[model samples]
Target: MGEVTEYVAGLHEPARSSIEGVFFIAREVVPDAEEGRSYGMPALRYAGKPLLAVMEAKAHIGLYPFSPAVIDAAADLLEGFDRTKGTVRFTPEHPLPEEAVRRLVSLRRDEIDAAIGRRRA
Candidate 1:
C-alpha cells in the first residue's frame, strides 16, 4: 500500500473510476499478483515486468500496460482520448465497460505468448 495506490483506489467515480477499475480487473486476472507503487504510480505486476500501471493525469487517469499491443487490440473500446506509448486515458465518471477490459487483458496475454513464440521460432 503506497501513496499512489491509496490515491488511485479512491477514484471510484464514473469518469475516473474506470482507470482504477481496469487496474482492479488486471490485478485479479494475473495470478499471484501483488500491489505496489513504482515510478511514482500504482503498479501491478506478474512474474517480473509491470502488467498494469495507473496514474492521475490532467484530464483523466492513465491506465498503462507494459505492452502497447493490448491497447491497440481493444481500440474500439478505447475510443481514443489522450494516449501515449502504452497509456490509455479514462475518467472515473465515464462508463467503463468490464467486458472490454477483460477482453483486452486476455488478448494482451495471448499476444505476449505469440510474440514469445516468434522469438523462439
Candidate 2:
C-alpha cells in the first residue's frame, strides 16, 4: 500500500475515516497526485509540489493545502471551521463538506501548476 494509505489505516476510527475521506476527495480532484510526504506529513503531491495533507491532531483533524492564499480564497466555503493562515481544523462530527474539500484541492492544484509553469489545456 502507499504510504498515505498506510498512515490512514494505522489511525483509529472517526479520525481514520475522516482523514481518509479528505484524501478520497483529493484523489478524485487530482487523479495524478502521487502519495508523498511534505513537511513531515503524508500528502498528495501534484506537479512535484505539496497539494494537500490531512492529519489527526489532539483536538481536530487538520487539513493543510500548503498555501495560505488558497485557504484565504476558500474562506467562504470554510465557515465555522477553525482555521489558521495555512491549516483548517475540523472534526469528524462536523466533517468538512465534500464541496469544500474539492475546492481546496482544485485551488491548490492550480496554484502548483501555475508555479511550475504548467497549464491544463
* Among all candidates shown, the one with the greatest TM-score: 2
Local distance difference test scores for all models:
0.64, 0.94
Model 2 lDDT per residue over 1-121, tens place: 7779989999999899999999999999999999999999999998889999999999999999999999999999999999999999999999999999999999999998889899998
Q: Write the per-residue lDDT of candidate 1 for residues 77-113, one digit (tens) a residue.
A: 7674556668777676664477767766666655655
Error of 1 at 72 (Å): 1.1
Candidate 1 lDDT: 0.64
Q: What TM-score would each prediction reach against the true structure?
A: 0.69, 0.98
